[model samples]
Target: MMTDLVTSQPAMRRLRLSPTLSKYIARQYLSWFCSFFFAIVAIIYLATIVDLLDRLATKDVSLGITLNMAFLKLPYLSQEVMPFTILFAAMATFWRLTRSHELVVARAAGVSVWQFLLPVLASSVVLGALAVCALNPLSSVLLSRYERLEANYVRNQASMLAVSETGLWLRQADESGQSVIHAESIKPGSVALQQVMVFRYAEQDRFVDRIDAREAQLQSGRWLLFDAWLARPGVPSEFHEQLALPTDLTADNIQDSFAPPETISFWNLPGFISLMQAAGFSATPHRLQFHRLLALPMLFAAMVLLAATFSLRPQRRGRVGVVILAGMLTGFLLYFLSNFVFAIGLSGTIPVVLAAWAPAGVSLMLGVAMLLHLEDG
Candidate 1:
């Protein structure tokens, strides 16, 4: 009996696939899915662009600048709609599988549901990572360009930037002196003035002295004016004097005179925050934006999970229209809640980090719970 059993036990074999077959299947699936996704995205994108153009046209925006601004805005629009595209694609794919009973056949062939989900999970991860790293950089560049274009053609305003080649000129006034500073440049968080000149006026607009310097830098809380020359009002025509001039303004004061942080990119948030603090300005919004950027991937994952929970239920006996409506309602509610939390976060009622992450965290937990209940329990 033992010898018979040993002879009956054949060697286990592994299944193999031909490279050509594998490539063909991959190409087919990619072609089908990409076609479907792009079609939907194109329709939505075009509608949005048309509406924006119509609104701007009424405001006297030139056609060329309007087109440029709209194209520059495409990256942000794509980012905003990508999660919805993922949801629709997943729903359509599963619906097709169910309608044709392909899912049934796969299950009959011993393919687990988890096994079927592996490809989707992998794709979602790759897309999420790309949205953060590659897409964000492109969006930042386009956004900067769009702002400049808008200022030039659409809006009659200019955004002041910090650096300039002609040097930094600022008006300063106090009880002791009224001074206008002309320096080669002003560093963000440090006072390093080059080719400095200070024109001083005495009480009742009397000329006091003019001080010129080769270089000046901020140390501690004062500006150490250096390599200086002083010309007093009563000096002889052939003679000029040299003297050291001191200032109480520091690097922090300079930075406080600029615009807010909403215009900066995610990549520059950390450095900007440090500079803002060094310049004695509140960096709360910048810190919040940093946390919000960090939470985007989790938020996107939660969106997918929420979509699956509502749309992936067994529909053999249920109304398909009702299911679709339910999915739409769920998506809308999630969107509303996320925006509400973001508004609260921006209002400073809660801590910046907590406010930025709370919506994503809650949505993820709710999605996971619903999925586990439906799929496992």
Candidate 2:
């Protein structure tokens, strides 16, 4: 009877603490996360407003519009700092538990490290998924709208480029009034357009002529059109095997003119990448972005693991301030390293998948190594 009672008591105690501990840790982590997230959002919003006010002050942009732009940008900015938020949240949660001697008590009472860390880790995973699946789409939409509003009202400019399953449309102006070019597709890394149509305008925005070409390649100072058809207002259309269309536009300008990959939603990226690829445009940027977002959940979980590695130890074991500073420094290094590798990926120096995932992979391994050493070695 005594053995049964004793075992029953311990089992019941574990059953009680399991859920309670998870709830406590989850709540603590969430509190810190929200506090950190909102604080960062507020910081970004304020900074955005200041820049807007400075740039748009004399551009006929109203105070309301400026505030709206700032607010619209917050969602996208929030994503940029999410990993940091997770890191700070984990550190704060563990630090508080350690300072209050709660963690020490839990460890002494036979609570395994993973047992207490599970809630925070799970939270990190969920938050990362939500960031990709929910926040990302919302941010992408709002950012597009914001860019449109900024271009129309503040910049007084036309949309740079429009791409779809059908084709690509580009608009540019020079000493000659303007031109709208449509192409069924493009050849990657070169300004070579297939099934191209160019609508030309003369000075005073007069409809001057139209040229249709089976193919066109942009060279030093002019477009080399192949199998071209030239049509004019009153003159008969003429066909030629080759033609030179003078232009001020360059490969750099055309490449720079595409909408940044950041503006595309996660759900739309795969389709967009396909379209770009079929159109013979390099989709490296979009591919990199897609991989980066896909890796985000794992990266966030790694952040939590790394934080726990640095902050879970009792403060009495080391100088608390120094330990925290070291942890933060490590986080900073990770951030810069991620940026550096991502840039390399963008430049095609390495595979996009590797660039996007390397930081998270390294962080996860480092954390697991530290935990093994602490718990088992």
Candidate 3:
């Protein structure tokens, strides 16, 4: 009985992380993470700058503007690569610690794998929280600015569509001038507008005429208006059963004009989703993005678990190269799975909640199972 009590005391001590050990492990993990982050970000920035310069070679854009656009675009690309960064960082941290015999020392002291992993898991969760709360908003703002710059300097597209509590507004420009269109309601999946009004302006912003139409349909580079009444300056009003207005706009252009999900911040996503739904448009993409941000912390933790499975084995174990190759393959597979599921969500084939959460949830479970098999078996 006394021998058992003595053994249990040491085991209990091994189960808990001492303050010094926790800090040491956490610092090691964070150092690796920050190093990998900066390295990856630098690589992405350089590649993007090269691509942008190539694309803008024909345009009269200056180096300053190109650099500014690249800098603004960095945060969004960073967010996209963050998951892989975490995976690589955690793997490198564990592998280095094991190689240096630090984790071996802890194991020799009877510390379990889970006990030593606690610090890394906790740190990943904190990083994920910071990413979602602070980094995401900054990324969204910078990405939006980059898009605006690209539109103006690269694509030469004006802001074409906007939705509000009042209704939808559209503007199109041509050699003649510009026309502003308003519609009280739009069909959910088509370019059909009801209760439409069109205001035409000639060069120098001179008002030319106004047209009120019961319905407007965009077809083949023209707006086909039904039951339309046109009023011209210094002329009598005219009524027409059907009228065709020439436009360079098409269904594809109008659809592409909507703001993409990545342009919205995490804090603003819920409100944006609400506004989009209220405007009678499907909010699936925004809702999916919101839920994805919410699930990022769990995903980070899952990455830690997966890294541990591949890297925690002793150096004496053979097949190190095979194990690393397998780990990388697993990460790639998970990434493809995530993108596929997100595509499914965007298509509205599955619930937004399920599609957003499934990849992370599946990764967490797979990691846990792998760790259990490795550590316990």
Candidate 4:
């Protein structure tokens, strides 16, 4: 009777102390979480710098430009790498706890596994929010700078504003009229024409004239067309005549005619879409990208949940290696599935918003289910 009473007293003491122990575990987990997070970021940054140096070695870009480009590229890479970093950090934290037998002790103290996971989940939520609100804007700025630097220094080929398998197309306008130009191929600053056609329309919505050029070169705010044929669209079809054409339109002017979708930022996406549509350009892809950005926070949170689900199991089962592998595989599968959905969305097979958010939603559900099963079972 005396021994049984002594054993019961210790059990009562542990039950009373469980909350304090759980809180202590939470603090330790957060400390490890932060340390691992920053370490991973540093390692990724160093690897990126090394790779950038190798690529820039053959180029004549200035050091300042190279450094600027590298900084700009970091935000984009951070977004890509951060989710996985969260996973690895969680794995490391849990593994360390398991190795030290702290987890076992906590479990034995009547502290449920879910009690210990609260801190990790909180940290994940905080990180996901930071990535979306703070890091996203920075990424937008850097990406823009990186693109500009690439266009200025690394791109040797005459930049193409638009291309199709059918042919190249551009919109050019001047004081006289607006023109739609189509050609087989454009060589940098020059328009190379196997078949070239230009439609000239008047401001009054009248048919003005058409020009067919064999070849054209943009020079000094003007276009010089050789072996050109002129026709008045409003006049007789038989009135076509061969001639040389000259117009005030240069490569810079042509470049200004069409804008790339990536140049727009998340904040400006709605306004930009309205502006693009008003200016008569399709804004489908830009709209899609905008929705995807909005979904990113949820995606990041889901990534954390997925990682925790795969790696938070008991270590005594001797399946640590399998758990790590499963975490990696889950991350990869989620990535590919998100991309596939995005592609389908872009192709108009699915709603853009649905495509963007569905993967994150699905993963989150799966993670929650796994957590409930493991914790309760």
Q: Which numbered prediction scores highest in TM-score against the true structure?
A: 3
Question: So what's the TM-score on candidate 3?
Answer: 0.93
Q: Could you report the Cα RMSD, in angstroms, for every candidate shown?
A: 8.5, 2.8, 2.1, 10.1
Best by lDDT: 3
**Candidate 2's TM-score:** 0.91
By TM-score, the candidates rank as 3, 2, 1, 4
- State residue 250's C-alpha deviation in candidate 1, in Å: 21
Using lDDT as the yardstick, the better of models 1 and 2 is 2
* lDDT per residue (tens digit) for residues 100-207 in model 3: 899999888888899899999999999999999999999999999999999999998867988777788999988899999999877788778889999999999999
Candidate 2 lDDT, 268-350, residue by residue in tens? 99999998888888889999999999999989988998898889887665588888898888888999999999999999999
- Tell me model 4's lDDT, rounded to 2 decimals: 0.69
* lDDT (10s digit) by residue, model 4, range 108-154: 88766666776676667777777766777678777877776777667
Query: Each model's TM-score, in the order given?
Result: 0.65, 0.91, 0.93, 0.65
**For residues 136-205, could you state the per-residue lDDT of candidate 1 as single tens digits?**
6687778777767666655654543243335556555567766666776544444666678878876787
What value of lDDT does candidate 2 attain over all alpha carbons?
0.88
